[model samples]
Target: MLIAMAGLPGTGKTAIAEAIGARLLRPVVSVDPIESAILRAGIDADQPTGLAAYLVAETLAEIVLGAGHGAIVDAVNAVDPAREQWVSLAARSGQTLKFIEVICSDVAVHRNRLEARQRNLPRLSEPTWHAVEQSLDEYAAWSGPSGAVERLTLDSVEPLDVLVERAVEFLGRPTSS
Candidate 1:
């Protein structure tokens, strides 16, 4: 199985992904670290690294699935193209694909979380609340592949453990739920 998490930054998508990965014992592939590595390796700051990062994550997921293991991807898949790429990857790899969109519907709380976050990855600044708002403004409506994709939209206003429990239930993993 390939579990793909989507939503803007500070929505708790990464935390959810990590929790799910730990619960399911699947490798979690995050695009942020890949993008940060690219920037650290002297990629021009102005260069578009999102696509490259996604590609790297896609390859990592493929490798994991090929090894007869499931993988989870943590990324801000706010657009159709990004979602489509994952659907394609799942189809080619013959794996069950699930998309879990993590969101904080409360605007004020979302902004506070975004502003208060510290950058854990070296040389990679966290996106500002304004940037997150812009992303929400541009976010595309997602519809999974007909009859083949499973999708879930989670409101991340709850506690982390509760959110992870919900994800485990959604994934039908017996370990946590």
Candidate 2:
């Protein structure tokens, strides 16, 4: 299975993806880490570096799928292009695609989380609340019908384990012990 998680920063996308990846025993490909590596290489992540990071992530996902193992992608795939790329990749690889979107309905909690969170990745700066708010505003609402590529929208207020279990079940797969 190829699980792709998408949402704005501070929405618990990483947490959900990591938990699900652990449960599924799958490799997690987070865009933040790739972007950080690109920046550490002295590339500006605001431009070409960002594009390169996505390409690198896509390549890695392909390799992971080719290895006959499930993979989870953690990204703020706010637009159709980003989401479509993963969908297309999974389609060609004959891997089941699962699209999960994490959301925090409580604005105050989301803001707090965004402001307090830190990125441990090298040379990667955390986004400000303003930036996160901007992303939330700009996020394109997903309208695709759910089927093989299941869409799970989770509230961050819920327990992490519950969210993970729900994701596993939605994918029609058993939860990891």
Model 2 CA deviation exceeding 4 Å by range: 143-148, 173-177
Q: Name the best candidate (by lDDT).
A: 1
Model 2 misses residue 104 by how many Å?
Answer: 0.2
In terms of lDDT, model 1 sits at 0.85
**Alpha-carbon deviation at 58 in model 2, angstroms:** 0.8
Model 1 scores worst on lDDT over the 10 consecutive residues at 142-151
Task: Single out the weakest 10-residue window by summed lDDT for candidate 2.
Answer: 141-150
Question: lDDT (0-100) at residue 95 of candidate 1?
Answer: 78
Instruction: Give one digit per residue, the lDDT tens place, for model 1 in 27-102.
Output: 8999999999988898977888778889999999999989999999999988888888888898899877888989
